[model samples]
Target: MLLMHSQVKAKTPPTGLMSNTEQDQQFQVLVEQHKGILYKVAKTYCQDESERQDLIQEIMIQLWQAFPRYNPQYKISTWVYRIAINVAISFFRKYQRRKSSVDLSDPPMYITEPENVEKEAQLQLLEQFIHELRDIDKALMLLYLEDRSQAEIAEILGLSLSNVSTKVGRIKEQLKRRFSNHKI
Candidate 1:
């Protein structure tokens, strides 16, 4: 159960027309609908369960704060993705810096059930490959794997469409190499 009930509520309603209750209700509904985005972004950036929870909380707080300025012209998912990815990247960097100073042994947050051991191993290897990527490339791969359009990814990550396409191709080749090396 992802903690969607954030303690941080918008201090003021977006339009100042709706009561706080109404605003909270509306925000809750939207967050609930888009909760999967939060989960995936958090999972991508955080390997430890506690760290993932902290990242999710930070993302939720950011989303709450930015809710007022959310443009209606953009899809909600796009906006959510933008904010969540940014927050996750920041969190990951901070965590990395702290980790560099302290040699903490982090454990995997979750493991696949033994339904198919080969598939599980492949998934774990893919996740390990993803974690090996640089921050921006990691974000790009996440969006690409989610099947987000290159244009949408460009918009979210503030990169040109051509840049996104090129980087995605490069990242795919890198992943393929890593997998092949492991296979042999």
Candidate 2:
């Protein structure tokens, strides 16, 4: 159970406006409602447990900063996804530059093995296949697997609808080939 850091608590608006408790409450609710977005993004981009926690904190801080300026017309989930994905990409890139060693043996912390051994192996393979994708494609696939609409994915990724569709089809084919090649 992650709590908001004190540093990210509601701050006075820049225009000499006092902080509104009501607005703060609203922001808190927004975060509570979409908290999974933070975790999923963090897990996808970070392999280390501590790094994932740091990434989630970073995402929360950014979300707090941007909350006041958030527009109401757009879907909240879409807004949250956009911010989380962008932060994860930047964080991953920074960590990659500083990383000294690669650890491929550890499974993602978010994955829980199913009862069936074959199913668990396939799930692990799928996760590996997803992690191999380019950053943008990885974001796209995450959103897609979450069952977001193509229109929503396009909006989140700032790609054209056709482009989103084309890339998704290609990624699916690539994953299929990987699985096929793994078979004896």
Candidate 3:
């Protein structure tokens, strides 16, 4: 079970609105339910372990700040994706500016039993390829791989359905060429 850290403190609710305790409870429930998405986004955007955790924390903070303005008409996942992706993109930009060169070293492997070595290898290769994509494309590909519908992806990314379709097709072609060239 995912638990919100103590760092996520209850904030003052808007006047004539839900109580702070009620708002915090609702936010906690939502965060717990969607934490996996947060983790995936953070990992995809930040390869450094410490930076990834910081990104996740930043994402949660931004989510809480924006929670009061959240519109229920949208799907919860869509809202989460929007906030997470925006935070990730901003964080990526800031990190890029701060560092003269980013280390592209292979990520640490975590295959203890080695039962699915081939599968793990393929996943790592895919992750490497994903990290090479542009920020928006990375978000789109992540959402697609997560089995989000194209419509949902379009909504989250603020792209038209046809544009999302085109981008996915192009992204797949790019990935295919990259894999073939790399002989993965």
lDDT of 1 by residue, 95-182 (tens): 4432222122334645556766777788889998998899899999999999999999999899999999999999999999999999
Instruction: Give per-model CA RMSD.
Output: 6.9, 7.0, 6.7
For model 2, the run of ten residues with the poorest summed lDDT: 1-10
CA lDDT for candidate 3: 0.77
The digit string of per-residue lDDT tens for model 2 on 78-164 reads 878988988888844445443323222334455454566678788778888888889999999899889999999999999999999
Q: State, as a TM-score between 0 and 1, how close model 1 is to the true structure.
A: 0.79
Q: Please, what are the lDDT tens digits per residue for candidate 3 over residues 26-94?
A: 787777777888889988898876677667777887898898887656777788899999999984444
> Using lDDT as the measure, which candidate wins?
3
Better of 1 and 2 by lDDT: 1
Q: Candidate 2 — what's its lDDT?
A: 0.73
| Residue 164 C-alpha lDDT in model 2 | 99
Global lDDT scores for all candidate models: 0.76, 0.73, 0.77
Better-scoring candidate (lDDT), 1 or 3: 3
Predicted structure 2: clash tally: 0
Query: In model 2, which residue pairs have backbone atoms overlapping below 3 Å?
Result: none
**Estimated TM-score per prediction?**
0.79, 0.76, 0.79
